[model samples]
Target: MDTASPAKWVPHPEGPEIAFFDTETTVPSRKGESYSLLEFGAILVCPKRLVEVFSYSTLIKPADLNAISVTSVRCNGISRESVGSAPTFADVADTVYAILHGRVWAGHNIVRFDCPRIKEAYAEIGRPAPEPKGLIDTLPLLTQRFGRRAGNMKMASLATYFGLGRQSHRSLDDVRMNLEVVKYCATVLFLEASLPDVLSAATPIDELPITRTDTDITTSSNETSVLVAHIEEMKLDSSNAGTAPSYTTVPIIEGSSGFSGYLEPEEVMTQHITVSTLPFGQFAKMAVYHKDVPLHLCCANLNVCFGVSTKFLDNAGRPKLNIVVEIPENLCKVLDKCDEVAHKMSQEAGSISQWRPLVKKDGYVNLPTVRLHIPTVANGDHAIYSTEMYQKESSGNIQKLVFTKVDASELDTLFIPGNMLDAFFDLDVYDYQQNAGIRLVAKRLVLHSK
Candidate 1:
């Protein structure tokens, strides 16, 4: 049973305009190790028609004819004497390219191993490699379709399972068997689920050739409509704030000091404070006392205010605070545990908040967080570039924030602000103690006015 012979080739008409190909090489490694193409076979099928079947098998002449012994023993059983009189790779380049042109290449495990090796062979022969654009991997398709019910479906196993004849390792037989699988996949899975649509969606747009002018015109129109809608929505949802808050100030000095008889009196006071936590059923409030005289009170709903704050100081040194109030401690824990999640959430919130008005319907907003790698500088603070947000459909899951890279500049710029302690005063005590303080540390301080 010589499986390599072309006379045994059989093709089906119901398959796609697909080329089922298989290559037998001297060695397995695609790069580093040299491998001669021992045999190549292809079965071309159009919808309901078997167009062509081709096979090219010849011994490769090695420079050191003695080295052919290794390949002859391992791959196709042929000796050095047999290949000494055969044609070189240069002789078959045109025929191979002619057969492969403008065809959707189909092969099992072609993505991981076979396709790369074939391309490498072409490069070695001083010819351009086959375009990967038209390639279709059958392995992923099979996995997606039959992964759940049919565990570990190998090419041989799939062929056997589908009652498509045996898949021999020889090039010609493998192509025939692959054609059968392609037929089965098309009839059983593809047509039912719209394979063409799936393929189009999976393929990147730049790879497809624009053959007709109408396609370009239609694509341009669709892009313009999307841009217009986005602009209109952004206009509707513009935010009031120009920039995010970094710090906020509170007015502690009431009046300027008076000078009498070359003596000036400055108001300076220090107070000891005890913090007490109170938990309401649906909320938490923090109270700061100077011997039971309430100095500051903070309240928040756990669902809304997540115990995070951003404060900005005005020119007068007075602080205006933007607090992420009513936030639960558990959710804060999740954010702290995952820094990437925190960064992503911050980016999304900052970017999407600008267009909040456009997202009128509940859960209509889709905010996608972008992750970037920032390089670290030696001494200076790490610089953070742009933060853009994409609104997407809500996933019904907590959005994750990720910080991909910490550059030297970001490390240098990182500093603990002086007012960070005062910002803690703004957090609901009960929520901080129960939800935040358990996982995070907070220190208190008193500032004297001059």
Candidate 2:
């Protein structure tokens, strides 16, 4: 999709228009690689009336077509030949700026992706990036408001969850898709919000606990079933009102932290879930000092790459181990806020451990890692079992895993580099037994299919 006739729009006239926009850019082949702007698309939505009044879309010719990698082409189906003669971003910057400047800019994942790309593009040309009257990044918004039962928080997943079909990935198509997805999510959220008690009561117990019935030693499907069980368990725990602590708006400004003051009071649900709860049960028969009631962490897709056993040793000279997982930059930002709240909670409870910040710095977190301490119950306690791994049998019932045992060696291998596991854990700040700092004590882990 290329050029479209935009509706006539007067900037800052009467009131501002809600500019829903999206961009398609060169997919960086390597880490830290820059994204080249290849396309831009937007529609001006009337806020008071709730209708799209204008739309604009255009293909942008990057300085180097080689910037579009094969992966990029596969992602959006845009090729060099397709945009060989298209207008460069420079040619369309004026129109884009005119349409977007002073408007409330909104898009899917724009805060972490599109918004930054747009700014980077302008900066490359030594020009000022167009300013948004206010910013609305739907990624965080919807993740908090709509909840993550849709699986991964990617746009395609959200679309699929709502039966909106595969996201076209092209600039304009994605913009339109983004709008429709938001509408669907908003509608569902509205109904839920309007009747919270009714919805909560009617909500099913599908998220409840699942126990493994059989000991089948066979397939990855078994592990997948265990993961599903963990997910269901999370759904039940997360629904509790006080279990997961919510937070007020933590306004993050781009570039310098000067507040833009463009955000409308009603345009954003500033409140969000911050401090995810710990597992529901206490410390069980595990080797470590078990809390009787285990708390659950908010279920998150975490990448556990390494473990350290020597730092904090137990009475038996065996190491009190901690697993390390990389945190995504965007999510790291939200978790930082969670860290603050957790720190406050622990302090209020008279904990004296030094608080550790979740996000070391802003902008980009390069495989930011956090330690998850795994406490052992005995000197010879090598047993590390996750909830029974399960796979779907041909008959569609959850079957037990071939390998149900998860010892230290197996855990070391299972949580190796490149393993992205969905985890439910406790965000515990400990000041006991010479171990202090926030520890993500994993209560459950579902191995992610590569």
Candidate 3:
């Protein structure tokens, strides 16, 4: 490796220029292993303008019999005799680097495996590795975007989904499939978003879908039993209703910063409420109220129920409710109730107006319409006005609130810094909710300290 110089390259165009790259290696690991590259290929595409294809395949001298066993010559169609006279890894390193230079690198699972392998190969060859400015991994992206149905999003299935033909395991075929994956990702998954935008938004970790069917494996034996009981109660409610209710179970993903759903139960006088649930992490809070009077409160790190809402039914036909309690410790009194407290809560729930808006802000300026907060991270307090309007905008939006009490320095600490504001723009207000009397779900929050 040339220690003083590394290959520097900019990514292809922001919108459509993309390079689909794939490599077939002798073995997947680098430590205590040496195997030759069987094939390497790349496909360059510029949307409707041009398509360039390049590939290189050469046998290599296997270091040992173990390398032969790992590669399975029958699968790769290469023999020990074929690689005896082949060129060394150094001879072809520059050609491979030239094809990948200055392009957004894309492959089926490039980020996890192919990327590291290529970098290692460059290090071994005493040449600076070609830097792929951006990467698009199809596996996790498909899973998160479409749930379990897309979990097994293999190259073949993705190709079929996009009407791309069969892809052989050869280098050129694999490169073509990689290109198809990019097109599908850009048009369908990214919804015409630019390559840089998609890359910038790419998450390195897998974020599982929020659903009740998914369980956190870190629960204790006792907590596991409680979760089972909660599911059982939901089943009982569904059976009692006679007809199945339309419902979907949402997983309370760990580290969720704010409330996910709200509860407005019909019964205003019921006491002895039972909540049986599992806490996903180290903290949770439950605030119980009868109408408007606070009746019970508890905090723990394990899941329990102090209140329930049977309004929403999960896909498995169970009544779902907004569980507002937070878990603060392993075991903090699973139940809380007082006769006087119950009565006060009942009165408060009864007195609450049915037409009250879901969100209330003291100084909210109804600027005659809703607006988008592009490139801004939501704080989980404001309503996600409309998915339809959100889809129409080329970008996202930011939520801005003026605080009268805080100075500029404090405000900077609370909101996005002014230096990074140019990447965002104020969305058209007409696309958001403007009705004063309408209740809306506050999906995000933005804190403006001053």
Candidate 4:
């Protein structure tokens, strides 16, 4: 490894292009293990023509070769032998910084993963990391705008969906593929936006009709069932609804952030139990979210066996409601199924809502957890909210938790964070305001003492 450190980088033109980049790192073998940088690849694209202006890619000799496990090699095909003679990241930091700093940054899921890894690399080398003029995470951006039509937002899946061949997983190849994927998706979206009626009639990209049986109920009065009323209504009115409901701007509901289909605690609980009647016997049970499976292709159902903590306004720019809960492994499998089903549906619908996976990194240890995003809608003058809050009593009666905004503000809350509760929910899909994907909609919940 080179011992000399690269000098601080200064952009000559102060960023006239969009910097698209990707990084390949050693997969952490154990919990809390930091990612070791293995490679860096980037390309500067002309914003006007959407063509590549400059490209750079290099393999980096990690600080510790032992960090590169067999799994890591399998993931990216980069082995210690391949990078043994490569330059260290410290040697190329200046070039990487120069190509990145002050430019609009674009990459697949960079905001969640790559961007952080770059910052961490800089922090390790005791240098200031590059800052972007604007950040565009293609994963969420496309998942939002392009929809899941191409399946999961992973670069490999998107490439395959568009018949762009395979993803090499190398930093340079991946970044270039990322740009191409974005262009294809943007073109499709542009065409659809320019002509909605024409596109709607065309069978959605990568989707077939889902033939759900009428065995799926359509009543709100049921105690443990899915309210298929809206699904049925959509089927009946779909001929005329013509994307109206999906983008309905019928004056945002006073308190409920414009979210419709609001259900009370009992109503929510019934819906969960109702849809979950698909019987299972031991190993024959089905799952939605599997760790090894792509999220858009699978689904899941989770049981929050622990008490929940409910709070308001914890997350900025979102509704004040949040319910944090833990997913027991047994339920994680089912919840994964919900993810798959909802993801496939969202893609077929060409909806723009982002999918939030139930099983996250650092999952499967002491029970993986997920947040129940409860966006409240108005009920007359009061702001009423549906919660992932569900209760199961000792007698086995399941109930949902309904809280008013005033009740949440009081903080003498029924669903306290960090407190365990018995809850039942479906990983249902929603496309309100073009925000699509699966969420844990509580059909049943139990609140313990105080």
TM-score of each: 0.36, 0.47, 0.36, 0.48
- Alpha carbon RMSD to native, model 4: 19.9
Could you tell me the TM-score of candidate 1?
A: 0.36
Per-residue alpha-carbon lDDT of candidate 2 for residues 30-55, written as tens digits (9 for 90 to 100): 33345688888887766544456777
TM-score, cand. 4 vs. native: 0.48
Q: What is the lDDT of residue 208 in candidate 3?
A: 54
Candidate 1 structure quality by residue, lDDT tens digits, 1-450: 122323233332223355667766553111122445656666564423433434444344544554453423444455566666666656655555655655566676554346655676687777886542255555554555444222234566667656555555666677766655555554444334556665532445453322322122122344344433322221211121111122232322323221112110011112343444456677543443344553332111111111112234435433322222222233233223233322333344332222111111222112211111111222343322122111111111111112243322111112111101111122122122123221111111221110
> Cα deviation of 362 in candidate 2 (Å)?
35
CA lDDT of each prediction against the hidden true structure: 0.38, 0.55, 0.37, 0.55
Cα misplacement distance, residue 224 of candidate 3 (Å): 51
| Strongest candidate by TM-score | 4
Model 2 per-residue lDDT at 371? 62
- List, residue by residue over 19-74, the lDDT tens digit for candidate 4: 78998888654323567888888887766556577777788889999989775786
lDDT score, candidate 3: 0.37
Q: Write the per-residue lDDT of candidate 3 for residues 1-450, one digit (tens) a residue.
A: 111122243233333345666666553222123334655656665433324433334444433434553224543555556566655557666656766765556666555346655776776667788765555554444444433332235566556554565556555567766654544443343332335555433435465533221132133455344433422232212112211212222333335433223222222244544222224367332234444443322111111112222345445443332222222211112111222332344344442323322222221221111111211122354212111110000012222332222121122122211101111111110111222121121233321111
Better of 2 and 4 by lDDT: 4
Model 4 is weakest, by summed lDDT over 10 consecutive residues, at 241-250
Best by lDDT: 4
Error of 3 at 316 (Å): 12
